[model samples]
Target chain A: MSLILARIDDRLIHGQVTVGWSRILQPDQIVLCNDTIAADPWQSKIYKSAVPPDIDVSILNKESAAVFLNNLPLECKTILLVENPEDMFDLVRRGVKIDEVNAGGMHHSNSKYEMFEYVYVNRTDIAYLRRILNSGIPVNAQSVPGVKIHTIDKLALDAIESIMP
Target chain B: MINGLVVTHGELGVELVSVVEMIMGPVSGLTGRSNSGKSVSELADEIKELISSDNDCDTILFIDDFGGSCANAAQLAGAAGSSTRILTGVNLAMLLDFVTWRETMPIDELPRRLVEKGRQAITSMGPVQEG
Candidate 1:
């Protein structure tokens, strides 16, 4: 199938995805779906440099991304990258047939707590992730290929209790 | 915070950490050791002391080169505690990656992931990366 993996990573395309995941998934193309980057030409070029010469890179907004993904050749092996959980949520809401998303590299920030060394989230971030999970979409959290998969159990429970007294 | 030790020939390891600290702020859970004046056994003992004392978190030992005395000493020290992992050819990016990622990875897997992260950071300069 053309769509080998759909991934949501905060850092977008960097070393871990290019060298690490690409070695395992072997995608011929990488689609980065972000509204701001699509509108900005220079930012798009910067992301392009990070990708290998052999692989193709597409930076597009969600609406355009839906169209671009729909039109890709059936034989084309592609891995779609999005920076935010909401963007992935938006893609599926627009009817992109992404069944699952490999969640990776949510780097720590002051407002965020470290779930793992590479994965970070705030209370609000967990809620957004739950939205995807509740919609029957699987969010597998793991940084490198073949490493242990991080469960959303703690985040999910926090999301549930967040609404309660 | 996990523990880290950067081992290098002469004072390179010590100086690299100083540069890294300048760039990334004061890094916790990391130390730098140089084999400049110390014997292999002395260096190995220093590593073992740190590894044994850090009872809370896992430790990663970074070496500047492989097949050298520094690497040998690190490997010998790593044997005493399975918590210690030695990665050869440690660069600036690799050290940054190790400190950032040690929390997410088990001691057994941190070195592999850090190596990959370091490899990704290295590339021939291009205009697209310019500010």
Candidate 2:
């Protein structure tokens, strides 16, 4: 597949993606899709610097990312990254064919409830995640390679039921 | 004073800080962080918090290995820019040079100096020929 992995991590490009997943998937390129970060030159530079020089890095907004993913060469093994479920949903809606989605890291905040040790979500996040799961994409949370992958569907369902008004 | 933070796997960061302090005599604003049981985001958050705590001082993150978790976390912290710098392949000599010259040396120049010191400390140490 052109797209080897699609991950939703608030910290888009980091050790987990660069070292953990890269070692396992060994993708030819990493594509980071975020409007804000793509616009900021400094943030783009920081993300690019995190990855080794051997692999290609693309920092593109959602629309550009959709075009890039659609026409990606079959030989190109690309790992797609978005900061949140909303962005992931947007990409899916934009016709980016993804087999599975990895909810890598959301982190804890006052507004977010813990789904896993590393994954956190709130009502709005759950809503976006539900939409993504409803679209028939499997979402799993695994912080690093060689760890148990927690299916996020059940957790999202449970979280949705708990926070119901 | 420019702050220094050493990040590594296991107890290396903590031990490095302790050893440096033992030699330098209780230097302030220099600390260490470990990536044990912590995700990249968690470690990045900690680094960001430490940097934010000392907003006035320019902070330098010394990572034990390049392309490792510590270096990745430092990059994710988004603290690499004008005020904050991330230096990989950290060693005792670099930390020592950092502690010695941080107060007086310009922040931009200190990274190069520390790297030079670290590189200079490594040698073949082979038996010398009798002269």
Candidate 1 lDDT: 0.79
What candidate 2 gets wrong by more than 4 Å, as runs, is A154-156, A160-165, B1-10, B13-131
- The CA lDDT at B79 in model 2 is 73
Best-fitting candidate, scored by TM-score: 1
| Predicted candidate 2 versus true structure: per-residue lDDT over B14-34, tens digit per residue | 999887754444568999889
Candidate 2: tens digits of C-alpha lDDT, residues A7-83: 99988887667756776688999999999989988778777877877789999999999999999999999999999
Can you give the lDDT of residue B87 in candidate 1?
82
lDDT of 1 at A105: 71
Error of 2 at B7 (Å): 15
- Computed on alpha carbons, the lDDT of every model, listed in order, comes to 0.79, 0.86
Colliding residue pairs in candidate 1: A117-B104
The alpha-carbon lDDT assigned to residue B58 of candidate 1 equals 79
Q: State the TM-score of candidate 1 restricted to chain B.
A: 0.86
DockQ of each: 0.09, 0.03
